[model samples]
Target: MAQKSFTASVNAFRDKTKAQMRDVFSEAVQDVIETAQQPKARGGRMPVDTGNLRNSLASGLNGSFGAPSAGGYIVTLSQLEIGDIAQFAWTAPYARRMELGFFGTDSLGRTYEQPGNHFVGAAAAQWPQFVAKWAARVK
Candidate 1:
């Protein structure tokens, strides 16, 4: 029987895997940015308008699968400020009051409870789907 070796084939697979992993991470980051930019009510009961907030969303990727050692890639999603003002209204001090509501009632004497926006939670929930998509694409 002729002796056979897979060293060359294994090396090729490793290189392809590394390249595909980078593509997967890049696509994942873009997905996160797009999700964050979606128009949705924020700032709880106050319901901060999307306005410039959606435009402020951005994504960044750091490191790569081919890096030395065991270092891995990192994807970061950020809300950048527009001009000197913060784009996200949730960063304002009054955001908390809007989320938790107040004890006082309006002129009609009818009170109401403010609700939290839950934007962060909602975004986190999509992470699993994003990861699955990445895995499928890489394979």
Candidate 2:
């Protein structure tokens, strides 16, 4: 048998995982926004774990051979102003969940700490992707 290159497979796994994660967070955020925008609703804050995604092959072999994709994006309200949350609070329940906590200041003199009711014990590796997706726009 010809030699196999597992490097490509490994990289593919990582890239796919990252992309999927980005998409998941983007969608979750969108839902939060949508929910908050609805009329006659109290916008609650986003939960630590938003919710669970349906079993799908595209997500992974999770249905039968892979792990189930965890739903929800752990986020903070640092970039969002109170008005923004209020505007979306009508539909999205989590808009009200936003909190202002203090951890420490960064080089830019910004407060960087865990917001209220965020997913705790998240893998460190997922941080960059989560933040990137949270900041990016989703159609």
Candidate 3:
């Protein structure tokens, strides 16, 4: 029947869309990892938990659904620092308005006594652009 054929087509389209979203999330993680690498460093690469990044993005998208911030996506980067502390506590600090925390600190420590400026490199610098790109593909 035509109804059966239409159902199959819709299912195929859904599958394809899911695959595309996954690809987008993977690329976003790759972008963060690549940007985190320090060129002059000996290893020339940094170990990033990309799985976490992927999960975070998925969670963000899931969270965004039916809520005020629904359809929003997040990718976490842990290598950047401010002074003696790792700057990004949750996700792209320099770019996204997100939760932040400091390493080797306490509930009330001097590490955050004074606010400091943190920067995300050119690739991961724009939060709005990143969000918009993923939102369009997330269904």
**TM-score for each candidate, following the candidate numbering:** 0.48, 0.30, 0.37
Candidates ranked by TM-score, best first? 1, 3, 2
lDDT of 2: 0.37
- Alpha-carbon lDDT of model 3: 0.39
For candidate 1, the TM-score is 0.48
TM-score of 3: 0.37
Residue-by-residue lDDT tens digits, candidate 3, 76-114: 222211222211222322213211223445456634432
Q: What is the lDDT for 39 in model 2?
A: 29
Off by over 4 Å in 1: 1-5, 41-50, 58-114
Q: List per-prediction Cα lDDT, in the order shown.
A: 0.45, 0.37, 0.39
In model 3, the worst 10-residue window by lDDT is 80-89
Please report how far candidate 2 places residue 88 from its true position, in Å: 8.7
Best model number under lDDT: 1
Clashes of each: 0, 12, 2
Quality of model 1 by C-alpha lDDT? 0.45
Q: Provide the lDDT at 50 for model 1.
A: 39
* lDDT (10s digit) by residue, model 1, range 88-130: 2233444445445556676778785656554444554677788
